[model samples]
Target: MGSHIGGDELAVSNPTRAAQEISQTIFSLDLGGISTVILNGYDAIKECLYHQSEVFADRPSLPLFQKMTKMGGLLNCKYGSGWIEHRKLALNSFRYFGNGEKMFQRISEECMFFCDAIDMHKGKPFNPKHLVTNAVSNVTNLIIFGQRFTYDDRDFQHMIEIFSENVELAASAWAFLYNAFPWLEYLPFGKHQRLFRNATKVYDFLLQIIERFTQGRVQYSPRHYIDAYLDEMEQIANDKAASFSRENLIFSVGELIIAGTETTTNTLRWAMLYLALYPSIQEKVHREIDSVLNGRAPTMEDKQRMPYVEAVLHEVLRFCNIVPLGIFRATSQDAVVRGYTIPRGTMVITNLYSVHFDEKYWREPAVFCPERFLDNNGNFVRRDAFVPFSVGRRHCLGEQLARMEMFLFFTTLFQRFHLQFPQGSVPSLRSKLGMTLQPLPYSICAIRRQR
Candidate 1:
């Protein structure tokens, strides 16, 4: 009975319903000769992903996953010393460049460009989608390649479009089937082929940047992530066991760009949507920003004084639930989670949608209430179950950078303009699932505020 129900649940796209149908916290499915387990409930998820983190820290060998990530990349690599070494190297590099004053200044400048673009809408109803995407992706570009592109750059736009297209294809039902049955790859005529083609384009684009840096025509001062990685490779050049190979470098750059861009872009887009839908809440957030900054530019330090703004952002992440299914994981060995024995090499999926919207963890999960994240003194409160970035050892490496971008971009935008849906059109909270849960294509009007 558990197996049948679990199989049905896995077949569906809506994770919330799948969690509801399963009576047990952990449900196992025989997915095309692979043993897969779906973990629901906060406690069950915590145990599998957290308490027994090592037992479930590897990447699954799915066909679509292999094509999309190659499992050679930092994001989808198998659990082992190679993954650990690269992860640590990437984290240190991020730390070296991530929180520097120069980085923050760049983000602020990008936000200015973003606000300028929105202001171009002339108070008329226009879709802020591409504008936001350009600005958000520019920040990632700066981090990865130490450069930003003009919004009108056709090559850059095409690359982003390809990246976006691949993300949507990843969420399609075809991706699910391909992952389950690897034999589908040879049959031809499916999105799986397009995914590989796009992957090649993305890798080629990334490699050009690396080749430029390595060709010695450009001075290398270890300016950004790519340069820093090259420095590491030089230092360990003689070490045969070093994981800092050219292949890892290429994929690591891909990981940083893809991971950093889409999720942050989607979250900021959702921020505008929610603020537009709830004018009262929007006003409250605006008041907080206005009071704290006093018309000056926002700094990370100002985050403490603006509790309501922080709460609203947190609420947005919770409400949006971007990356609902999250990155898939595989077991390192046989493990017992919540009294269930999940075998070795099994695919493990922690149903984040179930945990985020579970009534047991939240008071009113469906309602967009930022107050739930605030305490009696109206201060921000952190909830353990608020795992938008996922939990445990294999959590998102970009968590800190993402938070910085979201808070800074969000506050700056709201500080400059009042976001609302276009005239005569209702704000639709509909989301189209992809690599992330993106807000459906919608137009929003940003009315500039008077200082």
Candidate 2:
């Protein structure tokens, strides 16, 4: 089944169809194995998933984290009593540290820097992947370490490049093989080992950053994520069950940076590509921006006035949820759902693509249409299926910032220039699934938009 995709078995090239057929067993049908259970349908998937007191919210065990991190990775932990403590502490810490007026100012300042950097590209043919990731990463960096890096910074670029590769590898067949079989991970394939090694290197860097921040080596007031964690650690110094330890602190930063930076940047990349491939839609967006923005950097307030642009952004997310099926979850214990008994440890997944593109909820699910999100008054209206940031207890920690980041960066860029794909090349708008759904590597020319 690992290599079965795109083969003759399905005889179809559609990802949604393939996903539906392949994943019809969690509540409706069952394949014969104990370890393998496929979640079927959107409602059954959501019902069985959201009810799990998060007991099944544990990520699947993988060799890289298990062996490399010694099984203490925050992202992989089960959502039991202990995990609940950690999750709550982390969420509280995020709220305390981020989204404040000062942080919003920081985000705004960095975003202007981002605009200037793109201004250098000058609407030319270029691969904006690293730049886009770097800009978004800088937001998390400021939140985590209270620092910024130049685009050419060697170490920073290495980390982003390696992390991006890891994201891609996570969706590759190789990772699937490694996760399913523990022993094969040790084999000398440079691909598998290198990715894990780079991850450890990243962890080590994160740990060092944590140590430096704790040691007061970076100087100035520590107002970012790590600073908040250190502060919590100090206050909870006497609490026996405190989850604000050094390890959890590091993991929180890791999850925040990785999850926060990767998703927003990838979705922006996809949006740029789609806009480039389709000019009339791009023109409409530009027209909306012209009326709403009036030649100024888009303020957060401008979002309400700019309906078409906002709807287009929503459509971009709807069509290509970076983590298409979202993070895989498991069952808390044996429970009956949709007339079927699911055992504990069953891998439960939410097919976001299913929800986003479900014909029941959407019209012309295959085509790119932002108007679905527009109301009669032309305000951006959200649908129940708009779970790009996810829903329920474990929604994205950086949802607020991610939304702000996407709207700000996307509208600013589009208002300034028209994105165009390379002449004579029509790139596929479909994403390749991984831990995140990412667009294939492609370049686009950004022709400056006429005033």
Candidate 3:
């Protein structure tokens, strides 16, 4: 039996009912401002949820997510025809900005810098949070502004820290208050107000960059995302149908930076935890890397050859809950599921953790088994349950970039060194729950593997 989402009081009273089939009990009242929609035993079914996106495609009314997002800045935004227009342009923006070419090049270079920065902490258990955060943010910087920063760059690093701090508030108590009564933000002692101020700073920073980058030739001439967006704004200069203003461009780019950065960085951090905890698994991955390319850094093409290595990456994302409960989605219109008709504006969430760990779909779902991704024929076929990036129209825009960054950053570091938890400190699997369920912070030494 599964529980259904109702109003706030019902949710608060019936939260354990929402925990359903999960072994790790959820603290009631929705930490991140939406209750978990437990799927129970129905997860593997094709329409495990019906009217899923149709009944629930609106972004939740959380002031924290909404304000930070600037009301559906991109991914977690409400589902509407407006989304179609925005997503199409956003997808085009990815290409126009040379997302696959110059962007990937910047990603590779910045990721290499990440590896190098980690390499600097050689033989010392290092807290990689800030360096990794900066490294991840730089790829977005490259895409949005054609700029990349060293891990130690003060200006970018400060932006990264502030952004991280502000987003983390999404899972805090005040986030719920802000969502329930957005007016609370203006009240004294409200941290949400401070976050709004910081968000304004970030927005201003983006505006400044847009003001700087848009200088020179016709807006669309360069064919970059900003250029193209600016060109559209010029065409629709007076049209109400146009959301193609310079602020939109800045916010969209800023959205990419915020959404894209911490996730890949956190996943890398979790991968490190997995490596330290399971040295043999680490050895096997390194061995695969060694055998396939002989000390060369991994590439997307190399994934076809290194099956085990690919599986390791999958397992890392599966086990690491970077986006817990996935991004909130609400019903755009009334729709029925299992004979129950959820009304319009009904908020919905997919069971991201459940989908990853459902027993029917996985063998030893609780264990870190990379072999699950490989079939008897040993082909790395995509699993239906791999919805870490979400699915369908609302899928992540930075997925390809994330995959590429993870592969390069991860494989490069493994090529140069092996990591170990500090002396007498055991690797902890106990996750510190956050907006993403992060593994508790711990340091590890990257001892260079002798060639």
Candidate 4:
């Protein structure tokens, strides 16, 4: 398997394409001597990741993650009682600050700022990367730090830059080698070294913020994630076996910020690019916004009435296939999946790209068609194969929050601006792979609409 499919192939190429070449939905490859199973297609993925979730609930201890995190955070932690406790607390905290009227209001407020920042371009062609990232980061900031940073804040901007760099580097060839060979870190130079340095800088920055909150935080009265976590730590102080610790807190907060910000930011960026590439679709979205919103701010309630907009967003997620190979999972116990026996501790890779593009489930899967998500009457219809967030336990923790942010941010932008390519500049749909599948740098003009 290793001879036929090397680490470089897995690192650079789409897993779905590799699966197609091999003509197997469930196949195993020896990744640097580590036994790894690739689950492709919707049915195969559904049976294992959805039905037998617990069997594949544990995260594989990649050398890269183990060195950076020491397996202490929610994302890379081993599945056990401690992880369960932390996940529950995180979910509860998300519910407390990330739901209902308050959550909508917070995202809506950020949406205005996002539009204002874009409006500064004055309809000229500009790269929307930083502005979009800042906008999305601010929403996550509100939940984690209880405040939002200004778009021009240098420190916040630096933090975001480093975070984005780390995301891309983590999926680089060097990072893959480092993961396969744990001892590569001892080398004098490599991208892995820079990865470590950037990680330390981010940790230092987060630690500073956590220290600031510690100064004024009151016990049992929480204002944000850090406060709530500190409160939990105090409660579990005497419990020797509990997993809540200062290190875990920092790692978890970092995870939340990255997970919450990067995927949604990139998704919105893709949405903008797609709209520019396809003007007819953009016109239809404008018509829906004009008919339903009429220059008014959009709320979550408005999503139900605007099927076309909803369909567009859904199609963006499906077509783009962000996070194609979701965070790798490990088998918690020996399990039989699709008549094959996967031993305990084997690494499991869920090919979300395959699920989204599964021919058995979608018609003309390669085409960029939003109407596929709508029925004959034009109402949005949910498809079973759409699993951008994955399925069952250990799926994206920020799924709900991401959905809200995407809807509010997406609708708000199209509601106010006419997004299109600059004159004589052709839009490119090509994507650069990293931790997520990001659209290659493209410029779009956001002309304000006459309401």
Best by TM-score: 4
Candidate 3 residue-wise lDDT at 400: 78
Task: Judging by lDDT against the true structure, name the best candidate.
Answer: 4
Per-residue accuracy of model 3 over 1-451 as CA lDDT, tens digit each: 1343345664456433333345232122343445434332334212534325344446665556666765755555556655665678777766666455556666667767777777777589888777777887776666666677776677667777777777676666777677767778678877677777778888887787778877774755754566766676678788886556565666677777878787898898899888888999999988888998886656667868988878888988986757757676665666555655555655565667766766657777767888888889866767876777876456687787788788878887788888888889886777665566666778888898897
State each model's CA lDDT, in order.
Answer: 0.82, 0.71, 0.69, 0.88
RMSD of each: 2.5, 3.6, 4.3, 2.2
Candidates ranked by lDDT: 4, 1, 2, 3
Model 3 pairs in collision: 55-331, 56-330, 56-331, 57-330, 57-331, 58-330
Q: Each prediction's TM-score against the native?
A: 0.94, 0.89, 0.87, 0.96
lDDT of 2 by residue, 198-240 (tens): 7788888878767776665333345566666566667778988
Misplaced by over 4 Å in model 3 are 1-55, 65-72, 98-104
Clashing pairs in 2: 26-38, 56-330, 123-446, 322-437
lDDT of 3: 0.69
- Give the Å error, residue 108, model 2: 2.3
TM-score of predicted structure 2: 0.89
Candidate 1 residue lDDT tens string, 1-451 = 1553546546476655555455236777776676788887777788778898888899888877776666776888899988998888778767877778998999999989889888888899887778888998888888677778888888788888888888899878888888888788897689887887888998898778688755543344777777777777788889997778787888888777778889999999898888898999999998899988989999999988888988898888887888877788999998876556777888888778777777777886778999998999999999887888988779988798888889899999989998887778976778988879999888888888998
